[model samples]
Structures are given as C-alpha cells and as structure tokens.
Target: MGYGKRALGGVSALALLAWAGAVHAQDEVTQVEELTVTARRQTENLQDVPAAVSAFGANSLYEDQVETVGDLQSHVPNLSLHVGDASNAVVYIRGVGQIDSISFNDPGVGVYLDDVYMGRVQGSFLDVIDPQQIEVLRGPRGTLYGRNTIGGALKFTSARPTNEVEGYLDATLGNYDDRRFKAVLGGPIASDVLLGKVAFAASRRDGYTKNLLTGEDDGDKDTIAGRISLLFRPTSDFSAYLTLDASRNSPDASRTPHRETPIYSVNTGALRPVIADPDVVEATYNDLEKLKTRGAALTLQYDRGPFTFKSITAYREMEYRTHLDLDSSPDESFGIYDFEDQDQTSQELQVLYKGERLSAVAGLFYFKENDETFAGLVGPDFFVILPGPTYFPFPANTSGLRLAENTSAAAYAQLDYKLTDRASVTVGARYTYEEKWTDNRGEWFDPAVAPSAEDMERLFRTGAGFNVTGFEAEEDWSSFTPKVAFNYQLSDDVLTYVSASKGFKSGGFNGRNTAAAQSFDPETQWSYEAGLKTELAERRVRLNLAAFYQDYKNLQLSRFAADPATGNFVAVFDNAGRANMYGLETELTAVVTPKFRIEANGAYLHSEYDEYIDGGVDISDQRHLVNAPKWSGRLSASYDLDLGDAGELTFTGGVSYRSKTYLTVSSSEVLAQDGYALLDASVVWSQPGGPWSVVVSGRNLTDERYREHAFDLTDSPGVQLGYYGAPRTYSVNVRYRF
Candidate 1:
C-alpha cells in the first residue's frame, strides 16, 4: 500500500479500536489523561477549547527529549522551523510565516514566555530550561494577542516554585564530541510566604563541517543558559513572581556554511569538482560569531471577588557580532564585520472575569525598543573598473550605521457567552497603534594601497567618522482586528465549531534600505475555519479534524538588495503580492492496548500567489509561496514492559514525512527542496519507585540528506548555496531526582 493509504488506514483502525475496546476490556477501561491548558489566557480543558492547539506537557517533552524549540518540527504537523545559523530562527505555520533574519523587520508570528512577549527574531531560538509546558496555537490570534499573530502564537510557560523541596540533575553525552549538563532546584524560602527556583544548562559540540583550508572545525558551538525565579504570596488573594534569564554563545564560524563543491558552474559553465558524497565540503575562511542575551520579568496577580487583575513588566537586551568571508575563497576578495545591539521594555495590564454563563479577559499593552547597528565591508587589495576593465591599485572599504526606535500601544478584549446550554459564541477585538523612526548613514573610503589594518584605519580615520549624520525617517500605523466564533456541543464527548478571524502585523522602516523609500505598510490576513473534536470508546481514543481557508494581502517578504558600496547583497523587507492558502488537518491518539499507545497527524496544503510584483515586474502567475510544503505528517508509537525486579522498560519510535517545499518568496525554481523522511527511536530503563534512570536516543536512523535553507546566489556570481541538515546522531543520558 502507498503511504497516503497507510495513513488513512491507520486513522481508520484507531476509530475501529473504539468498538474493539468496548468488548475486550470493559472491566479495566481507563481513559487517557485529560490535559489542561491556558490557550485563551485562561486555564481550561484542552479538548473543551474551540481552537486548533497542540500542547506538550513536561512529561511529553522528556519522552521526546526536546531541548530546543527546533526539535518540535519532528512531531508537529503543518509546522516548519529553520535555523540557518545560530542567529536565524524562522518559523512557519499553515503555509504562512516569517524569514526575516535581522533585528529590524518583525516576525509574522508572536512568541510569548509566561505572559510576556518577545519582540525580536534573533533571540527566539529558545532552549527549554525546566519549562512546565509549551503550546503552539495555529491560525489567526490577533484579537487574543496583538502584533504579528497573523500566522500563529507560541507560548512557553516556566515552572513555578513549590512548597516542597525538589531538584533534578541530568547529564548527556553524544557523538561529535557533544557534552551537556542540566540542573534544577526549587523549594520554599519561608514556608508558604516565599518560594524560589534556580536552573542551569550548558552544552558544547564539535563542528559538523571540517574546514579543509584551515584543517579545523568550522561550526563548533559553546553555549550556556541560566535562569532564576522567585514567587511571593503574603496574602491569600495577592501573589507576585519575578524571573531572570540569560544566555551566551561564542563560535568561531563563518556565514559561509558548508557548500557543495562546484559541479556544473552556472557562472562559468565548466566542470569544477565531482563530489559524489555530500558529507564533505571545502572552505577557506575561519570566521567568528558571538552572541549574548539577557532578560527579566515581573508579574503580579490579585483576586477581587468577582474579578481578577494582573500586571506584567519586562525588560530585554541583546548583543550580536559577525565576521564572514563573502567570497568563501582563500584569495579574500571581500570580507565583512558586523556589531549590533538592542534593548526593549514592555508593560501590560489585564483583567479577567468569570460568571455562571459569561467569561471575559481585557488587556492593555505598551512596548518600546531601541536598536543600533555598525558594520564594515572590506574589498580586495586590487580592484578594477567595471566594463572598461582598467585595474586600479587601490583598496576601498564601506561602512554604515543605523539607529532605530519603536513604540506600540494596544487594547484588546475577548468575551465568550452561552446562547444555550449546548451552544456558545465568542467575540474579540483589538486596536493597536505603532510608530518607528530611524537614522541612517554610510560612507566609502579608499587608501590607494594594499589593504591592511593600518591602511584601512588611516583611510576611514575612526568608526565615528563613518556615520552618515543627517538622514531620518518615521512611520506610523493603526489597525483594528476582530474575531468571531460559534461552537456547539453535539454530545457529551463531541464538539463542532467554526471561526472567522483577522490578523495584522505592524509597519516598519527597513534598516538596510539604502534609498529614500525606507518603509513598507503593515500586512494583514483573514482566516475562516471549521473543526470537530471527538472522544470515542470511553475516552480511549481521541480524534481532531480541521479545515481552513486564508487570504493574505500586503505580505511582508524578505529579499536581497544590491549594496552599491560593498558590491554585495543586503537583506531588505518589502510588501509582496497577496496569496491564498487552504488546507485540511487531522490528528488521532489512541490507547490501543494495555502496553501500547499510538498518535498520528497529517496536513495537506494548497497555497499559491494571487498577485505578485517586484522591481516593476509581475511574476505572480509563476511562483508558489515560500516554506509552504505540499504535504506533511508524523506517526509515533510507544510500548511499555513490566520486568519484575529489573524495573520497567519502555520503547518509543516515530517517523516524519514531508513533500516538496519552496525556499524563497519568488519561488526561484532552481532552489526548490524535494521530499524527505526521517526516523527516530529511543529506549529507557528505570528503577522501581525510582530516583534514577538511563536513556539511549537515536535520530535520523536512516541518515537522510536534506537541506534546511537553500538559495541560488544571484548577487554573487550565480552560485548555489545551501545549509545541509544534520547527519545521524546518538546520545546516552542519565537522570537523578530528589
């Protein structure tokens, strides 16, 4: 049978299990644990919520060994997460998402931690350090949480301090010289009045790629993450919590990722290297990258009879450094260095009310951010005039600087009311106002000699002298987005619902814009969906299905722009053409036998551009949306065994499959990625009534070769560039709890 048939049969078999269980195991029937979630900013049963949300508790996270957010892609359907380097963490959902790598352009999706919003994409590559839960809500959420909820929202809730003393230590070792350790401690500082927790995690790994030129590793990683949280409750109705977190990474790597040896050069039309094996690459530069991030948040809540009130105040700071060899050659024709810094602050006030037949939440949010950039591009020792072909004995360096400030204010409210005992309706609205202003400046300097540190310093004099001084631009926008939904309870174990919602993203100045036109309008999307959730056979089986159609306009797209000074391409954001997306999704989970459990999910998508224009050229009819996979799905199974005195043993395995996907907004036909599949497995052994355990994990058992990011460099001499997926990896871990 084909894969698609197998998928449908598996789901059908799960439904049939309902009747089978009704006859075989009527005496020992036990349902799967019902999960609780804060999807609507209020605690509620996951199955009772009238939305498409995927929630993973701490136990699930441990079962999958999900340390980084990127690992979620293996299990989540209709989701794509890309990490080109340590700096770019782009996320896409349901054929809609963001690929903005810089700090200026905002993301299409919103990311929140413990009710506090994160505004930058550079720092969104989160490492989970004892988070209690992670929730991924699909579809528009603008009315629930403003700003960049056009695609979806991700919520990561940290674990809180408990009255009882608790702690855990976990250590791991893997191939590629990988080493890691994590520890968590929580206890009561003063009985019931005060509590606190501390968590720390660190990891290091050798580079997957070897630098043939330098005979050293190119992408080695050394990182550390730490967090501290404290909770205070001086009164029965009043409580407060404070959290502090920081992370740092230093790698002597390059923007020149592992590149395939040239086969048939598009630029020269000549055979260069016959590379039958994709595992190896030849590179010449030993580049450098450094990053640091720090943040703090405070939350207070008070119960006031029929109403509850809460406040959140947050501050964040980030610093990033980069050095790259643009040519990726030993000749050093061109090289670049970048230094960037950012700081942000946010404040929010919330009020929630719960009545016998009505529930509501109202919130006011304010945000402010400041960002600065200083960068330089160094040219070769000898250059030539274009077309005329006259070689000049001069070296020129290009420098640029930009500083931008942003502010946003918003008010949102959502209410759910019961129209009948089995029927209900929900309505929500939000109004957001934002403003951004930026100052841009740059210059070119030449020393008329062989390029050297001294020669370049003498030409530009100092970094301060390269400032462009008198260019400034500002943009302001206001938008109102709304949501409406109707839900009905058909029976005690079945629900059906339909929703209509609008999403919006703010306008901003393109930090890399080299012209007078430096800003683009905000993007908007409207989505309509219908879904059903059912519990069959005394809760032994659960199935969820959803269908949606979405319309997007004034889409925000990231592309490369020619930099006149450096003769290279710089990232620029623009308003691309509108697009349409429609898809079907289904998920099933079942407890088939006493020792076996199975879960599966699949998504089929059809997305295309309705209108597209770039540089006065219309290409809407020929391109597909970026990052939109034609089809994707996952299937996983687990089995448990009881071994008397030897304790218990468990085995788990999963397989994920994805169809063809595009890599760029323009859908450049040459850079498309074909279909691929991955296999993963794990085994665990534990002691009875236990405090200690061991686990062995393996990923990509078949060693599938794929590309995470692929691009045909139109700006740099028609070269094809791509970042290969990680090869097969293995790890063994030990854990102790007290």
Candidate 2:
C-alpha cells in the first residue's frame, strides 16, 4: 500500500475520551471494576501497570460478545488482526507486525497461553475455551517475554481445575444453518489432592456462497476443539498443572465478487471482475482449508516464604493442508495444493523473589522445532525453451519442499528497586540465540504434458528443462534485548511512568521458496513509551493514556513471484529495509450511575518507511505498512436492572470505527479500504444469580461490506484476489451452569 499523506484523524479519535464522559453524565452510573492481568509476568491490577495494556475480564467478554482473539480488534485500539487464507494471517500492534504467512517466518506478534509461546501464525486462530482472562500488551516486549515479539504479545489464561464441581453448557443457533455446541465439565477427582476439567467445543455452518458452476455451497464452517486439564496440590508449597489440548478447524472459503474489487489486465488494459453479489463463484478446485493441532503443557511451581521457583514445559504439533484455484476461474489454468507439518517443544525455568526493597525474576528458556512444507502448482501449459522458438507443450506441473529444524535458547533477568515509597526503577535484559537447518528440493515434471527427450536435450544441458536442485544449509542468529523504566506516583490516585525497550526477531530459512532467497537476517526495533494510569472521580472512573515511538531495522519482506520459465509460484524473502512508527492511545472506563457504565478506547497512528528499497527500486515514503490505520476507536455502554421477582436483565451496545487502511505495503489504489464502522449489541436475561441464562447478540449489525484482504495476484494480472469480512450475524445462545 502506498503511504499517502492523509489526515491522521488524531483529534476526532481522541475526542472519544471526552465525549464518553459527557454522555454518561446525563444518566446514572455503576462502579468501575478492577481488572487484574499478567502483562508484567506477575499478576497485578491493570490500573497499576506502567505499560499500555488492554485487559478483558470474564464479564466484559460475555457482555461485549467477544468470541476469539481476532474479535478484540473492535474493543482494543492500536491492535489489528485479519486473515486472507486459512493459514495466511497477520497481527499488527501500533503499526508494527508481520504479514508473511510463510511457514519459515515467525509472527512478530507473540502469542502465549499460560506463558507458553506459540510461534506460528498457522493454527493460531484461538477460541476462548473456558478462559478466565485475556490480556493484550502493546509495544515491544523483550525483557521478560523473549522470542519473536517486536509488535507486542497476546496472553490467554484458561480457568484451572477447581476442587468444587463447576462448569457450563452453551448452545447457539444462527442464520445460514449455523449451529454451535460447547460444554465444560470438571470437578475434584480427589477432594484436595487432585482436580480435573474437560471441555468440548464444536461449531458448524452451511456455506453462504453459491457456486455458479458446481451448484455447491461454499464458505461453510466445521470446527471442533477439546481440552483436558488437571491440577495437583499435594503440599502448600508445591503445586502443579497438566493440560492436553487438540483442535480441528475446517472453515469454508469464498472470494468476493470480482466486480466489487476488480483487477487490471496488462494485455487488455481493461479491468475485469469475474462475478458479483450473493458471492457467486466458478471454481475448478476446492478453495477450502483443513487444520489440526495438538499440544501438552506441564507447569510446576514451588514457593518458599518470599521466594518462588517455577518450571514450564510444553510440546505442540500442527498439520495443515489446503487446495485453491489460483486464477479464481473455472478453468484449470492454475491451482495449488499446499501441505504443512510442524512440531515444537519448549522448556523454561524461573526464580522469583520479593524483598523489602527489591523484587526480581530470572529465567532461562529453550525451544526446538521441526517443520516441513510442500507446495504444488499447476504451471502454465505453453512455454518455449530459452532462445524463443515455437511454443512447446511440457508437463508444467511443479512442486517444492522445505524441511527444517530450528533450535532457540534464551536467558533473561528482571529486577525492580524502590527509591522511595512512591518511586521505583526497573531494569531487565534477555539474550537469545537461534539456529535453523533446512533441506530444499524442487521438481518440475509431468509425463502427461510433454514426454519427449527431443525437447529435454538442449534444455537439460543448460539446466533449464525439468530442473531439480537439492541442497541443505544452516543459519544462526543471536541478539540481546534490554529494557529500563521509571515509575512515579503523581498522587494517591494517579501513576505515571516512562520506559524504553529493544526487541528483535530471529532469522530463518524461508520454506517453500527459491534457494537463493532461502534465508534472511534478524530484524530489530527500539521503542520508547510514556504513560499514565489514573483513578479519577473518587475511583469511580478509570483512564489510561500512552504515547510511543519505535524504530525498526532489517524488516523481513516476503512476496510471491512466478518462475520465468514455468510460471510456477515462488515465495521470495529479503531483509528489505527499515521503518518508523509512532502512535497515541487512550482507554477510558466510567460508571455514570449505579446501573449504567461506559467504556471507550482510541488511537492515532503515523507509520512510514524510513528506508524501503524493493527490487532495486526506492519505494520508501511511497508505501505504508499493512494494517496500520491513521485512527481507530471503540465505544461501548451497558445497563443492568433487577426484576425483583422475575429475573435480571442487562442491555449492552458497542460501536467501533477504523480509518482507511492499505492491504499491503505495495498497495495500489484498489488495495485500500476506506474508514468503516461496525455496530454490535446484546441483551441478556437471567434469574438473579441463577444457573440458567439466555443471550441475544448481533455483530456487524450494520451489515457493512468491507474487504479483509486485497491481494495482488502477481502470477495472474487479469484478476485480483480478495477476502470479504462477514456480514451481519446474529446468534441466540442459551447457557446452563452446574
């Protein structure tokens, strides 16, 4: 996306903070609730954290109808998430992130469950599974949580097993034949010594798109996930937790009407759109995806007075496969069959101590992984051997495979010292070392296309026709990240802090790509931030504001291009250039009356390439990073009432807005989306503190049509690829608790 100099929308986005306070004053109020989060590696009140953080409480999640981590974009400012294909996704925080879904490159945004790192973008579409809380920490996080975290981090905490018998059953039925069933059942296996919990979640829906040629439903949904957790506490000082999880997701896929998002044909110099409206598609192959994953984690903690020692060990594996018609046409001109297999294991040991004047946490971490990928493409049918002669037909079927092994280790320590009762200083650093070994091979052959030796003699001698190259290579990268901060209490009700941190993402061998671009160098970023957290109006209102500036270097860039001879797909990677981003964010929560509450979040961002050179072309200042919007915001309100004898009723509503955003750094005029708005609301009815309840919720209530991804089909210029956001969806959920 080209970086156009447009208005930043700073004034209007920030105005939400003031507007919310004024609107709520005309009504009654409720008390602002305290939210605790693990943003700092230790449990602490959200209002006490010095960094920029947005925490979702169990109640907030239900009231706001937040389903998955991706849904948080509507409620959290400065954070963005979207997916193009099943395995193609990106997460951006403050204009910094990764868009390459290649198996070789790890995500810039770190995903963690109970402190266990999830390093891949594939299979990261996590659904809330009896979760107690979710926290999103904005900005670079390296001192405490190392790994590929230059954008930020996402933390999810599931409810642990409890001795008391408790769980819930949830069911939902929606339009488009959507049906969902979920259950959480658990209790004490042995009263005080052991507790266990098991959960099952499943959802299925009919496709919304009608296939014009095949008369089949496209874009359906089929997903199921289950988890089992156990907690053991034989002694007061020793506690342990073991968890096993597995999930399978197969969501139907569909493309938007070509007319809605047209692409230009270089040959004709005309715009072409395949079809329009009702999501009608003519495809020669299935554009569906299937993903499966399994994981196990064991956590052990030992505490002695003011000192605690902890160990976390985890193993995870994922398998993903997909088939798509690259041309988006009914012709068998081009298509792909992609398969990916990945497995990883990690271990961490840490020690924590709290003294009268100092507090510290030190840890060591180890991570290892084995990943493999295979990409198949139907090459163009007509091709002439070099020297340009009459077109000769060849098999034209091409495929490539990359098998890799990765090892990573890190050691880190953080310490906090008190200068006074109201002032403190903190320092931390982590050193990480990583290495990757990869074996690559390629094949271009088809007995069906062209099986003549007369066509192979000259070409094969020149290393051109049906060429196959195999090689193995290794690369290693290391970095030291550090952070420092100072906090001061301006008053009993307010705290202000300033912090700076450095973060980096390790290099790796690019999977499913050309050997020449097989590896890249590590990328690094430095960020400085200042923030204030306050409790105004006698603790009835809460407001937190922060500003940050970041500088990035050696940003890895990935894109798709066609092989000159066969017109086969190739994923190319390069340590392109640098970028600078700065932004301001604010969050507000106020209780206007005993029965009413209002919350607001907003951000204004400015991002641009400081030095970006693409294909020996200086594109700096011309292209903007993907997912970075000049302004974004969300406002929400809730009201609760007690029906003395009948039941309790609650009403909630929210509206979110995002400014225009480019789909990619090489965004064309057609690859950008204008600012848009989304409306959501929910009504809850239940007996006061009862075990049964019903919720009626609606999302995208306005039914706005927007593009989720606007991809340039480099291999096919006549047609562009686009993914559309879901339209208005409503669901009636009934729940029962034990």
Candidate 3:
C-alpha cells in the first residue's frame, strides 16, 4: 500500500477507537475536565462557544513539549506553521494563507500576544514562557479582530500577577548540546492593592546541519526572553494591568538549504554536480541570525452596575538581520543579506455589558506602524556569448531599500441575545479604514563593475548605493465585515451552532520587487460553518465536530518570478480569481479510567481553484493550495501508575500524520512534502502535590526525514533547495513547583 493509504488506515483506526470509547463512556462516571476560553472576548466553556477553537493550558503545553509557537501545528487540525528561515514563520489555516514574509506583505492568520496584535511574521514564532493559556480560533475572525484575520487567529496569554505566591523552575538537558533554564514567580507586592509577576527563559542548542566549508554547525538555537507583569487595584470596581516583555535571539544561520538538482549554467551550457547529502552544506557565507523584539501594554478597566469600560494601549518594536545562501554551494552563486526594523502603536477602547438575557461588547481601535528594510542579493554571472557575437550583459545582482507607513482605524460591536430557554442568536460587524504609503528604490548591478566590499556593506546597511528610484505610491482601502450565528441546546450535555462570517486580508505593494510599485487587491472570504459539541456520562467523554464551506475570492499568491526590467528572480505578489474550500474536523477526549486518558483529532480538507488566470493563461485546474494537505490527524494517550510511598509514574505517547503538501503556490513536485508521520513519547515521575518532578522525553522517535520548507529555483538557477525538519532527539527535564 502507498504511504497515504497507510496513514489514512491508521487514522481511521484511531477514530474508531475514540468512537468506541465514547459509546462505553455512556456507562462511566469519571469526568473529563472542562476547558474555558476567551475566544469571543468573554470567558465561556469551550464546548459552548459557537466557533471552533483549540485551547491548551500550561500542563498541556508542558506535556506536548511546546516550547515555541511552531510546535502547535502538530496538534491542530488543518493548520500549518512552516518556519522558512530563522524568523519567518508562514502560517496557514484551512488552505488559506500567504507564502511571503516581506515587511509590506500582510498575513492571513493574525497572531496576538496578550491583547496586542503582532504586525509582522518576522517575530511571530514566539517562545512559550510562563504561559497561562493559548487559544487557536479557526476560520475568519474579522468581527472582533478587524485586520488581517481572514483565515484565523492565535492568542497567547501569559500568567498574571496574583495575591498568593506561586512559581516554578525547570532545567533541561538534551542531545545536540541542548541546554535550557526557565523560572517564573508571582506574588503580592502590597497587600491586595498591588501584585507582580516575572518570568525568564534561556535556551541554547547546537545545529543539526553541518557546514562543510566553515566546519560549523548550522540550524542552531540560542535565545533569552523575559517578561514582567504588574497589577494595581485600588478599589473593587477599578483595576489596572501593565505588561512588558522582551526577547533576543542570536543563533548561527539555521536555514541551510540542500540542493536537489545539479546547477545548470546558462553561460557554459553544462551541469555542475553538487554533493548529494541532506545533512551537509558547502557555503562560504555563514553569519549569525540576530533578532530582537520588545513590547509593552497597559490595560485599565472600570465596572459600574452591569457595564464595564476598558482601554488597552500597546507599543511594539522588532529588529532582524540575517544572511542566507540560496544556492547552498561553496561559491556565492545566489545569496541574500537583509536588515529590517519595524515599530507600531495601537489603542483600543471597549465597553462590555452583561445582563440576564443579553450580552454585548463594542470596541474602537486605532493602529499605526512604520517599517524599513535594506536588502542585497548576489547572483551568478549573467553575461552570455552567442554564436559569432560578443558577450551581452544581464545584470542579476541587486540592492534595494523599502520604507512603508501604515495607519488603520476600526469600529466593531457584537451582541448575543437569548430568544428562548434553549436558543440564542449572535450578530456582529466591523468597519475598517486603512491607508498605506511606500517608497521603493533599487538598482541592478552589472557583474563587470562589481562594487567593493565596503560599498556593498554600506548599501546593505543604508540602502544608498542604488542608482534608480522605483516608485512612490499611496493607497487606501475600506472594508465592512459581518457575522451571524445561531446556537441551540439540544440536550443538557449537547450544543449545536451554525454561523456565517466574512473576512478580508489587507493588500500591499511588493516589497522585494524594485522594477515597479505593484499592488494587489485584498483577499476576501465568506465561510459557512456548522458544529456539534457533546459530552456523555457526566462528561467522561467529549466530542466536537465541525464542517465548513468557504467561498474565497481574490486569493493572494506569492512567488519568485523574473523581474521585468532586469530578468532577476525576485519575490512577487498577485491575486488569483477565485477558489472553494470545504473541510470536516473532529476532536475527541475520553477519560476511560481514573489513571488513563486518550485524545484524538482529525481533519479532512478539499480545495480547488474555480477560476485562476496567470499571465493570460487559465491554469486553475493545474494549481493547488500551498501548505495544505488532504488529511491530517493526531492521536495521543497517557497513563499513570500509583506508587505507594514514592511518587506516581506517568507514560505518554503520541503520533501525528499529514498527507502530501505543497509548499509553494506553483505546486512544484520539488517543493512538495510527501505523506509522513511523527512519533513522540515521554515518561514522568512525580509525587502527589509535591514540588519535585523528573521527565524523560523523546521526539521523532522513528527518525523520520521530512522537509518543512522548499524553494523551487530550478527554472531560474537550475537548482532546487529544501530545508529538512529536525531528526530524532531526547531530553531530560527537572522541575520544581510551589
């Protein structure tokens, strides 16, 4: 049987087991714990929410070893998070996302820290430090999250200051020289009036890939992060919260690409073979990837009667610099260096009302941002000699700078009204106005007149060597998104909901292209969904299922295409006409015994372009969505054995599978990842209500080889490149909790 068939059969068996467990749960008395979420701007039971949401608490995160945001995709249905480079994380949900990570381009899925939105993907792959909860809201979230949430949204909430002292300390040692330390503490500062919390984490690891030229390790990890939170309450109805967080990442370049094909020289008309190895690369340029991110947020709230007024203000900044070898060769056939700086400020005012039969939330928001980037690229010699003709110059090397400024304002409101004892309806809408201004300047360099090292470094730092100004343009856009939902209680333990919503991702100029300032229209989506949530036998078993259909228009796509003026491969963005997507998702959790538990989730997705036109050619039938797979699932279990005097021992195991996936919009075979599965296991020993614990964990136990990101440059440079995932590894962790 094929890999796809085998994966499907395994997932089917797991689903069957979950179903059987649900049936048996009808006679059991043990209960599964309930999860609370704030997906709709209000705290409520996860099963009672009208939308599809995945929530993970601190314990769950630790059990799954979710150290970073990228670790979340394996547990979610129809979700993909690909870390293409050191800091660029391409995120997709339900077959909707953007592939590019330029500063000007917007993301389909929004990432939020606390209540503040992260403006760029350059730092969206945040480390999980002292986390309270993390929530993934699937589908469009335009009603509450007004900008760039056409696909979905992710929310990370940290632990807050409390009146009582609480904290934990953990140290970990693993293979590949992995070392990690983390500490978190929270306590009262002044009786019940002031409270404070602080968290710190430091992690370092050696790279998995080896650089043959420099004898250095690539794909490494080194980072330090800290966060502080304070809460001041002078009265029972008024409160203030302040949060500050910062992180610094300095690691050896980890995006070491391996060549999939030999280099085809356009000038020599011959192929140059490369070393055929996935774990080794020959690159002369090896630089440290440096990224720094910091943010601050302040929230104030006042309550009167049944109405509460709140205000949130925040500021965030990020700086990133990196050098990458695109050709993965000893010589600098194709390389790139980038320096980016960005900052943003936002303000939000909200009023919430809670009543016997009606609940409502209304908000006004404003955001402003400034971003600048300087980039340089080195390409192979582009001069060619024809029969009985002199050589002609074809400049492919380029240096450029782009500066962008954006501002937005929005007004939103959502209300839920109870019609009968078992029925409720929700209505919400948001209106947003946005404007953007951009300055693009760049010039192609002739190989015959190569610049000096000092000049090249100056251009990379200040973007001053460019001789041509591409364009300066300003654009404004407005959108009105709305949502409606109906929820019904079928039984004491069953809830059903149907919803329809519209969302849009903002449009922008091509930040990498210097020939012209081009703009694409905003991509929009209208989704209709139905969901069922059930609990049986005193909540011993919980099952949630959802089905959705989406009408996607003006789908945004990004690819490396030839520049019209210089014939150089540069990142470009455009829009496809239309597409349709439909999918089914199911999640089950059963507490079969007091010490045994099982969790299973699966997704089935089907997507097709209804109308796609590329350069006057109709190719909708030949194209597929990027980073989307037909089937994805995960099954995990845990069991605990009691020890009389010592502690309890727990054993946990999990397996996750994904079908074939295309990483680029072109759906090139060289950029596709085949069906694959990953296995993980862990053993933990702890005393009941004790402070000490030990955990031994192993990931990718089978040593599976897979590609997380791939670039198809064969058409331009005659070589394809791929970035492989991590191999098998194990770690030992010691923890102390108070």
TM-score of each: 0.92, 0.90, 0.94
- Give the CA lDDT, 0 to 100, for residue 707 in model 3: 85
Best lDDT among the predictions, by candidate number: 3
User: Number of backbone collisions per candidate, in order?
Assistant: 1, 10, 0
TM-score of 1: 0.92
lDDT of 3 by residue, 395-423 (tens): 45677778999998999999999999889
Candidate 2, residues 267-320, lDDT tens digits: the string is 333444657663666565566578898999999999998898999999999998
Give the candidate number with the greatest TM-score: 3
Q: Between prediction 2 and prediction 3, which has the larger lDDT? A: 3
The count of residue-pair clashes in candidate 1 stands at 1
**Stretch of 10 with least lDDT, candidate 3:** 1-10
Error of 2 at 477 (Å): 0.7
